[model samples]
Target chain A: MRLLTALGQDIRFQFRHGFYYAYLVLTILYILSLRLLPESLVYPALIIILFTDICALGFFFIGAIVLLERGQNLTQSLFVTPLRLHEYLLAKILSFLLLSIVSAFLIMLGGSVGGQDLLWFIFGAIFSALIYTLFGLVFAARARHVNDYFVKSLGIGLLISLPILAYLGLFDTPLFYIFPTRATLILLDTLGGDYALSEKLYSVANLLIWFTILSAWVYQRFDRYVRHPV
Target chain B: MIRVTKLHFAYGSNSKDTLNGLNFHIDSGEVFGFLGPSGAGKSTTQKILIGILNNYRGTVFVNGLDLQKLTSDFYESIGVAFETPNLYTKFTALENLDFFAQFYAGETRNPNELLEAVGLKDAANTRVSDFSKGMKVRLNFCRSLLNNPKLIFLDEPTAGLDPVNLRKMETLILAEKARGNTICITTHDMHVADTLCDRVAFIVDGEVSLIDSPRQLKLQHGERFVDVEYRDGDSLKTKSIPMDKLGSNDTFQDILKNHYMETIHSREASLEDVFVKTTGRSLQ
Candidate 1:
């Protein structure tokens, strides 16, 4: 109850005029990009196209929001409230999860990507958002200042992207499956419901593991690390 | 009431303890002042008391409940106004109050009434970004009362305000004191400590050098003499005389009966001078 009440205000604040505009502009831009994508993705290079475009963009946006909060000192304010540490970690995942799902689904729908595959795309985008949002929180918490945050985040992003981007030339078979980008491929190919038992098991297990590790770090270290100097 | 015994807390594995063997108790309804220069364990002590900083080696009891034993319920009994105004700039002052007030299990006072007390009622509808530093400080003052707390923690509560607003803040603090609220104020400002604290602890270099009531501490260290000023043949002259010898001193009698007295004032130490005397460090 304490956590919900504290987070409610922050969630609502994010939906206010200035914040809402930013969210809207990002959503519109994403949808427009989908509309303008090469039709080749709808057929042949679907997995490559999905991993590179929507999933990547959504993760980048999540990082941007976390970095903004760090810059504005909202994270510090949230730290001082009578909230348990895990509550914030959970709230961020849940809030961003819901928002990105709605965002990804709308863009896929408006761009004429239809049927059950669209639902899977939304689910994939949500998983990717959760993973990267946690990643961004860890980085933002570790950063000493806002400018340092951006420079370091961009560096981290480039390093994480290296192998993923190399998939275009380095592999004859689908390489996205080794990464959580597998979810994005499944969604774009509309293969979520069609995937085998072992594949489903792998996706679920990896998601759970990442979430557990990130949440534990949040509980143990995030509070002390981000407490502003008095 | 708050009690801390042998409290020890450090930032990291390689750092020394910020709070080491700290022992103190604040009785119910007492206004306690923590006076220290920058980084002198003032904030560390306040954070420990407010449940913000944890993992410390200590036995801390507040309102008869152990600090570690209690959970979110501990926050319900106390209010805090940090030195920096951490308000939602996008929201109106009233909206900010309304949002935070919902988190408390305790009955909250009306936001408007508290804002009116601090002279921000007319500005309630205005966005917090539009408020000046003093206005924001007033808003923070209103925030501390919204929960109707039994204990209040105010850090540098009057640091940036002008003299007029500073007096208003002092009066508002007195009003809280009148209502039997135990307040723990942290500041490097000596005047705020002298005028408001019932008892103040002079913290210098992570240690408490002296702790006593402002008046009592002033009297204990003040000179036992009075400086008498009078105009003698168009020249202003002054004489320092021991207060005990005034009953038999002819010069004192002559001054009282003969020449017009320019000024008569008791020579007593300010709390700042007392702090310097005890700690050998300025309150800055």
Candidate 2:
């Protein structure tokens, strides 16, 4: 009950501060850009826009929220409550996940993309956002300023985007799967065509593994950050 | 409600200890002041008690539970008003309190009632960003009371308040005490410590030098003498005599019997004076 209340207030805060409206504007622009693109370019644009704007942007959103909360000493107040670290992290992840899901929906709708692919798009967007949001929590954990936070966020986003080259058929190395981005892109790719059951399972299992590791690391780093934050 | 023994804490591996081998305890319904100058570890100790800073080498027990062992539910029983106001700037004063009130499993006081008690009833609908420093402090002080905590921690509770708000805060604190709540306040302001604390500890450089009631400390460090002023012709004359035998002292009796007395006062030290004398440093 307390967790739900906290999440509700956080959502209300984000809405009242125009963060949700900003998300709305960004999502509409991405969808409209896809509509303007040539028919042949729409497929590749879908790949880039879905991964970069919908998935990776969630990282920046979480980073921005963390920095703002730190400035207001909101984390210090929340730390003293009955709210556990995981519960807090879950609340943040869920809030951003909702935005990511909406962004995915709008992109797919605008492109006339549907069928089982929509389910895959929604699922892939959620897990992708979760992975990057955890990464964002680590990046912004010790940040002292908004500029510093974005600088680190940009750096981490670049590192995570390495697998995008392989996803685009520019890099042929199988080792690219080590990064969760490759698995996420493959999941989205499979959703658009008929693929072997084993391949889909491989992508799902790989992303889940990465999610577990990232969640554990995020929990530890976030605990340290709130206990003795910069 | 709080017991700390050999409480030693340092910020980092290479940093010096902020609180070194400190020990103190407060009984139920007691108002104890942790008095110290800036950077003297008063806030650090309060943070440790409130579970903000952990990983210290010490034994702390608050409300009969070990500090290290206590979980988040422990916070449900205590309230904290930080030295700097920490309310959400975008939210109205009442909204901030109502939002925070939802976190507690226990019943909480009405946000408007708490604001009214602090004389900020009119600012209930105002955003915290628009409030003055005094107004923010008043709101912060009352937010801590929304939970109706048994133990409260206040850091510089009246730091930036005007005299009127300051008195209102003091009265509210006294009211809390009257209701049998334990308060542990951290402040360097002697007047605040003198007025609200039943007992105070003078801390300097992460160590305590003295701990006693304000009246007892004042009397212990005060001079046992009285100064007598009288009118002599067109001039005013003053004399100091030992207070032990003032009634029998010939000079004092002669002056009182023959001359018109102007003023007579015993030299009692203020809390600030005693703090400086005991610590060899002023409370800045």
Candidate 3:
């Protein structure tokens, strides 16, 4: 019940702060960009867009949100309430995930893509958003300002995006599978259909493993840098 | 409702301890003030008690619960107003209060009533970004009471208020005290400490030098005399007479009979004077 209430406030806060409006504009642009592409190119383009941008919205947004709250010293007021740290983190993660899911759904619909595997698409969106958002929070916890967060996150973001080289066929190496984005790309590829069940299972298991690892790292960093800052 | 013994805290392994062997206890419904200058461990103690900064070598019990073992439910019974206004700038006064009110398990105060009590009813719909510093401080105070908490922690609650608003804040604090709520105030504002606190602990260099009522402190440190200002012929003159034998003092009687008395006042030390004398450091 407390988590739901916190989530409600977080969503309202995001809405009032223009997160919804920003996504509305961005999603429409993504759809328009995809519409201009040739029919043969639409599926691959859509997957690339979803993997690189839509699913990663939380990664960029959560940093701004957390840093803004920190700058205002709102965390001190917030943590003093009955809300636990995990609840607070889940509320943030879920709120941003809602935005990412809605944007991905609209983009796919407007792109005239049909026969897509809706279940896998959503699973990919959820896992990708969850991992990236948690990843962003780790940096956000240690950053003193939004600019600092972005500067630090950019380096980490580029390192994770190395998997894109293999996806684009520019560099194909088995080591690319070590990055969580490889699992995200594989799951998101299911939207194009014809993906084997074994690969889907591998991606699901891989993402879950990555999620568990990131969750632990996020919890420790947030507890140290945010909850008990010196 | 709060007790501390041998409380010691340091920011880092190499740094000096910020709080050193502090000992104090506040009774239920008592208004306890931690009076000290900036960097004197006043806020550090409050944070430790409120479960914000937990690394300390001491035992602190708030409502019989250990500080180190506190759970989320521990916050249900307490409210804290930070020294700075730490509110959402985009949120309306009402929205901010309503948002926080949902976090508690039990009954909470109505947002509108809390705003009205703090003279913020007219601006309830206004975003906090538009509020003046004093208004934000008032709204922050209102947020602290939303839980109807049994114990309240107010840090420099009246730092940015006009005289009228400051008095209103003081009156509201006193009213809360009357309602059997224990309040711990951390501030260097001596007037506030003198006006609201039942007992104040004078802290300096991480050590508490004195703990007593403001009235008692003044009496103990002040001279037993009264200063009289009188107009004599062409100029105003002043005289000091011992308060013990004023009625029997011939000079005081002669001044009242022969000259037009302008003003008379008892010579009592202010809280600031007592703080300086006791702590050997000014509040500035």
Fraction of the real A/B interface contacts present in each candidate?
0.17, 0.60, 0.81
Please give, for residues B208-249, the per-residue lDDT of candidate 1 as tens digits. 778899999999889988999998889999998888878888
lDDT of 3 by residue, B224-262 (tens): 999999999999899999999789899999998899999
Q: Which candidate is the best by DockQ?
A: 3
In the order shown, the candidates' Cα RMSDs to the true structure are: 3.3, 1.8, 1.3
For model 2, the superposed segments whose C-alpha errors exceed 4 Å read B245-262
Which portions of model 3 show Cα errors greater than 4 Å?
none
Residue-level lDDT of model 2, residues B1-284, one tens digit each, is 78899999888664888888898888899899999889999998888999888888889999889888868898887988988888889899999998888888899988888988888899899999999999998888877887899999999999999999899999999999999999999998899999999999988999988989999999999999899999998999999999998899999999988999999999889999998888899888
lDDT of 3 by residue, A18-107 (tens): 989999998999899999988888888888888888899889888999988887889889889998989989999999899888998899
How far residue B152's Cα lies from its native spot in candidate 2, in Å, is 0.2
Q: lDDT of each structure?
A: 0.73, 0.85, 0.90
TM-score of each: 0.88, 0.95, 0.98
Clashing pairs in model 1, backbone N/Cα/C closer than 3 A: none
Clashing pairs in 2: none
Greater-lDDT candidate between 1 and 2: 2
Q: Candidate 1 at B135: error in angstroms?
A: 1.6
* Candidate numbers sorted by DockQ from highest down: 3, 2, 1
Tens digits of per-residue lDDT, candidate 1, A1-230, equal 76676567656766763545675676677667666668755433334444554445434444455555555555554554455566766766666565555655665566666555455445555666666666667776676655666687767656555544534455434554455544444444454237665655566665567667766775555666655333
